[model samples]
Target chain A: MDSVVFEGIGKRYRSLWALRGVDAAFRQGEVVMVIGPNGSGKTTLIKCLLGLVRPSEGTVRVNGQLVGSDPAYRQRIGYMPQISQFPPALTIGQLLEMMRDIRGLDAETVDDTLVGALGLDRQLEKRLSTLSGGTCQKVSAVLAFRSRPSILVMDEPTAGLDPLSARTVLDQAAALRSNGGTVLITSHLLEEVETLADRVAYIEDGRLRFLLPVKEILQRSGATRLAQALPVMLSNSATP
Target chain B: MTKVYKYTLVDLARNRFVLAFAVLMLVLAEGLFRIEGDAMKAMLSLVQVTLALVPLVTLVFTIVYSYDTQEFTQLLAVQPIRRSAILAGRLAAIATAVLMALAFGLGLPLLVHLPGMVSLLLFAANALLVLVFVALGTLLALTQRDKARGVGIGLVTWFLFVLVYDALLMALMFALSDRPIEPWVVPLAALNPIDLARIAVMLRVDLAAMMGYSGAVYQRFFGSAQGILLALGLMVLWAAWPALVAFRVFRRKDL
Candidate 1:
């Protein structure tokens, strides 16, 4: 069974169909990248898979269980939203501690890992309001990666990170996949996706335009860079 | 379920806003009791502020909290926990936090006066109000989705409860002055939670002279076993209606 599956999944919001007939499966130890332009239903797909938004048609299953039926499916998955809002009053340490407490994970080891990797030990006491955008993004990254759940779903995970922070996140994603974890990530940055993804799923206007192995896509497009190859694929798909 | 509740309580306790509000309530209640010189008046005043105003404030706060934590909620949704359990955990955390604040705010004053059965009754009344309003606020938040709109609806509902409902009732009474509808108005008066709270407390103080004609009217009809039961039922309904609506909406919502 696949680690995550979307079979004929569709989501309708009023008159707008945010996603239509999305069919895909993600396997353990695979790093899949979902790429699309803004308003192309990337977030909607993620939300549907997470069971935050119910699909209007078809089913979304994770690890052979329907997401809607089992709430604990989320416990096996770690999600980093595109934009996170932390309570201004809470210190970085306090926020991380709260998340750990909510998930019922031990604090000592997780805290140590977070401090060492993210260099958050010195900034632990600083309130979230006092942190810069990049710093806040670092905190979010630490929280998402700390639990090391079997399945990781991150939306625009590296949006505001410094180059080093971004590299650390990418390395972590690669490590998780090497450990037989399923990692699904979405981003507008083509380079990150090209480097980290084993499979690429391209979406346009709420429809799946293409899904193929990263190497196949790169070879077929005959473009040296994913940034160049993406446009060719989109233009070709746009005609039909 | 127990684990969820425990974790929820911990989360609520750690929230800085809840902590600050709880402390502020206690301080205010203490100050009111010291200045009032009358125990009943102090209690009455505290109930008005705590049950009426605090719940409204807390309800709006909860709505905003839920909206602001959309990402967090999304993260939790992918977990092994049931969606209902997640919502229940959140609701339980919010309800317990609000109740604790109410208790500390009003409980301190009651302790000073050494309230009897009357205190328990007041507490029950206040609890009903809090539950009803929180549920209403949740439903409003779910329905509106927008933070500003939800807060606006909450404020309007508060105004209706605190001001408009009574104003409308008074207008109706004046319009019906010629019909001698005093007997029929007794049941209608029981419909309002604010009125019920006022009557419950006033009855404890002195139903005979303090309530005047309204007191006699209450005693004549609702003063009976069945009438009192009916009044209590209305209060329960007030608490139940919004909660039931919220639960149903939440169950189906694509949050």
Candidate 2:
């Protein structure tokens, strides 16, 4: 069964439709990279799945449960937002502890893989306001992975990180995939998409243009690289 | 909800804004008490100051804080936390922090100088004003997505409640001076939360005569237990209605 499904999802903001009839599904043990231009509903689609934005029409199902009022389904999901802004007054340790408490996880049982890997344990005393953009991103990455979620949604997860940190993040996502966790990522980095994505979900103009495998995209476009194949695939079938 | 509230309260406490407000209140109230040299007189003076400052500070702070925590709100929204919890937690924390400041700044002086029913009433009035304005601020913040616009609206809202509403009422009273406007004026005064708070405390201190016609009208109309109950009910409603509406708005709101 699909771990997540967006069935004919539609979201309209006043006169503008931010997302219209967006239908897609992510199977377990696969990383689906959501790709799109700016304001093309990539974030909107992810927000809809996370119940951050309510759809104007249609339903979303996760683990066969309908997404609406109950937030229980969110427990199994981890999200790393593109913008990393936490309570500036809080130390990194306090923020992490708060998240752990909210999730009702014992401190002893909490996962510290990301914290250790990102070197956040040492800087846990630092206030969020004092951290640089890259450090904040690392903290966000830690929060997303600390919960050991079955489904991961990362929006521009590597936009601000140094190359090494970004590589670590991609590796973590890969590890999650190896463990049969489903990952949904949106990125402008086609290179990262090619390396990490099992299926590429393309969205444009508030609609899902295509959701194809990397190999299928390369084969259909007769191109050796995903960067070359994306344009060909998009142009060939503009209405998917 | 408790976890969110706990974290938010801790965050607010750690931030200097709440503490600064607390210290300012303490100094002001302490200075007033020292200068006046009379507990009743100091409490009376504080009534006016609290009535103005509580709403203005609460309005501006809540709106600004809401915008500041938008990203954190997103993080919470993706967690297992309900939107209502998120909304309630933030509002509660704002109220708690502001109320704490009011208590330390104003409550301490009131407790030390004037330990009476009137001082207690003034404290309650300040607490209620915090609730009303915080709710209004939450509404303004949620309705206006842009931070500058939200804060702008908050200022206008404060102006309308604090100064404009009274000015309008005074104008209405003057225009209708020839007629007995008590019947209409009573409900009109009740419409503004600030007016309601002022009247409640003003009447408790037996300073209605000093409040001019509006106070006399309220004393005559709301002097009875039933009328006071009705006023109290209205004040409670003032605190709750906006918060309830904001909660609904937040639930339906797309983050």
Candidate 3:
């Protein structure tokens, strides 16, 4: 069974259709890079999959289970939103402690790898509001990886980070994929997409424009690099 | 739910705005006691102060906090927690923090100086009032996304309940003074949660006259034990109904 499935999902807000009759499946243990133009429903599709946005029609099945109304269903998924801001009063340590309690994880089970790589231990006692944008993004990335979830859904995970931090994040994400975690990621960074994706899912104007393997996309576009190939793919899809 | 409730409570307790309100309550309570000298007189003045201010602070603070906490709430929404639990935890924590500020800021001071059932009733009424308004504000937040508009709605809601609702009710009663509107009194009072709380506290504090002609009519019905229960029940329903509405909106809301 597919790890995630969106079956005829449609979302509309006051006549503005965010996603319309969108159907797609994320194969088990495959890295699917969700690429799309701004406001083309990429984020909407992702939110729908996570049950943050209820669909106007149809359903989402994750590992053959219905997505919303069940806390247990979310335990196997790790989500890193494109933008996240937590309460300023909480220290990083406090937030982590809260997360641990919420997830019912043992205290000893904290994922030290992401924490160490991000150097969050040094900043654990600092208040969340005191951190800079990139630092906050680092905290969000680290927290998403804390539970060793079977699925990771990330939105622009590397957008705010410095080059070195971005590289480290990509390295960790690739390692997670290698360990059989199914990832549904969205990014505008073509290099990150090429390095991290096993397949590409492109959406435009609330429609799935293309869902293709990296090689096929590259071959069809007649370009070796994702940055160059993306334009060709988008142009080819735009014609009809 | 317990974990979320704890963390949220801890977070709100340390909120600088809440802390400032806490200090204001403590100072006011202490000053009012000194000014009145007599505990009963002081308690009466404090009751009026709390009744006006609690709803205002609770409503405005709640709407602002609710607006500000959307991002974090979104984070919690995606967590492995039930939708209802997420809401329940946050509201419970807000209510708890509001209650703590009330108790520690004013209740503690009054307990030390006056140390009577009147002070206790004031505390109880104020606590219930905060919960009711917070639930109301949370519902407003859930229904409306625009921060300015939500805050505007919340302010108007506070103004209506604390001041205008009673004035309008009294005006209606005055317009029909010759007729026997006695039958309409308790039910009308029951319409506003703040009024329900006021009646509950007033009856206990021996200020039935302040309630006026309708107060005299209300005294006949709410004076009874059954009426007291009804009043308390109405207040609980007031707090609960909005919470239920917000939860329904929340579960179906596309954040």
Candidate 4:
């Protein structure tokens, strides 16, 4: 079953089209990478899927239910926002504990797994505001991944991570897909997407321009590097 | 509903600054009561100020907190919990926190001066005011979506209630000096929550004389059982309107 479905979804801010008639879907266990230049509605598309922005036209659904009709739809998904701010005084441990409590999950086991996965046991007591950007991203990643949500919607998830942390997160994403979880990730790191994504969906000017298998993209662009392939893909599909 | 309420209470309790502020307000209230020999008079004045100002301040706090916690709210929205539950949780948390603060600020003063019915009335009035303001604040915060603008609007509304509303009433009275104070005018005072609270408490203390002509008018009309009932109804409306408006906005909002 498709974990996400969008049919003719569009969002407008005043006179500007943030997104226009975007049709897409992601099935369970698939890793879909969304790539676009700035103002190409990459973030807008994600927001609409997450029910953060109501599409002015068409429908958005998660697991076949309308986005607005059911709040429970959110529980099945984990979202990592591009820019997230934590309460200034909360420690990493406190943050995790609070989310767990709010979600009504047992803290002991989840805390143990989170600490092991992120190697954050040492920084558990450190205040969120004091943490570096990379550390904060790690905390966010843990929060998104902790519950083992069925669907993960991450925006720029690996932006600030150190190389090792980035690799760990990517590995986790792969593992999640293997376990039948759906992952929809957006990032400027084309090389990372090339390494992890099973399918790539390129959007331009608020409209979806390309949806192709990763291998197909690599073959068509005739480039061994994703960095080399990205320009080729964009230039070929520059027209709306 | 209980989970939302419980979470709100817990979050409010964890905020050190708010807790400290509540403590400070309680101390001030206690000191003021001790300094003033007439307990009823002191309590009445203090309740007036608290009802008008605390709600406004609480509203500002709610807006700032909401803006600061935007990411948290986004995460919460994705949770399986209902959107209404999320909003209710935040509102309940803020209202409970502010109510605690108001209790500390006004509770001691009432206890020191008029410890029984007067204290209870003051507490009830304070609670109503807190709910009304929190609801108002949430609506304003959701509507404005900007911390500075929301806070500014909250402060202006506070000023109007705490100072300008009464001043305008007095000016109106002065302007109508030539006409007799009508029975209907007494009910108009109920339009302002602060005014109705003042009337209710002052009537209890037998200090209606302090209000001059307005006092006389109130005694002649709403001074009886029906008048009190009407005043209470108006107060309920004051608290209800903002809450309903806020709930409507939150239900439709993207985040």
For DockQ, the strongest prediction is 2
Pairs in clash, predicted candidate 2: none
TM-score of candidate 4 versus the correct structure, residues matched by position: 0.91
Candidate 4, residues B1-255, lDDT tens digits: the string is: 566566546656767757776876777677667777777666766766666656666767777777777777777776677777888888888888877777666775566567797678667777777777778888888888778998899888878777798898888888987887574466568767778877776766667788888888877666776776676667889988888888888777866
Ranked by lDDT from best down, the candidates are 2, 3, 4, 1
Task: Tell me the tens digit of each residue's lDDT in model 1 across B113-184.
Answer: 746866776776776676766677777877887888888878887888778877887788778767877776
Q: Identify the superior model by DockQ, candidate 1 or candidate 3.
A: 3
Q: List the residue pairs that clash in candidate 4.
A: none
Report the Cα lDDT for residue B2, model 2. Answer: 90
State the C-alpha lDDT per candidate. 0.76, 0.89, 0.86, 0.78
Q: Model 3 off-target regions past 4 Å? A: A238-240, B224-226
- Candidate 2 lDDT over A1-240, as tens digits, reads 599998999999999999988888899999999998899999989998899999999999999999998999999999999999999888999999999999878888767888888888899999999999999999999989888989999999999998988999989999999999999999998896578889999988898998988788888999988889889987898444
Give all TM-scores, in the order shown. 0.87, 0.96, 0.96, 0.91
Chain B global fold similarity (TM-score) for predicted model 1 against the true chain B: 0.87
Write one digit per residue (lDDT tens) for candidate 3, span A172-239: 77888888778988998878668778899888889888888888888888999988898898877633
Clashing residue pairs, candidate 3?
Answer: none
> Who wins the lDDT comparison?
2
The true-structure Cα RMSD of candidate 4 reads 2.7
State the lDDT of candidate 2 residue by residue for B1-255, as single tens digits: 899999999889877878889999999999999999777887878888889998898899999999989989989989997899988988999999999999999999889888888888788878888988899999999999899999998998889988999999999898998898988988998899888888887887788899788778999977665766677678889989999999999998989
lDDT of 1 at B131: 71
Model 4 DockQ reads 0.53
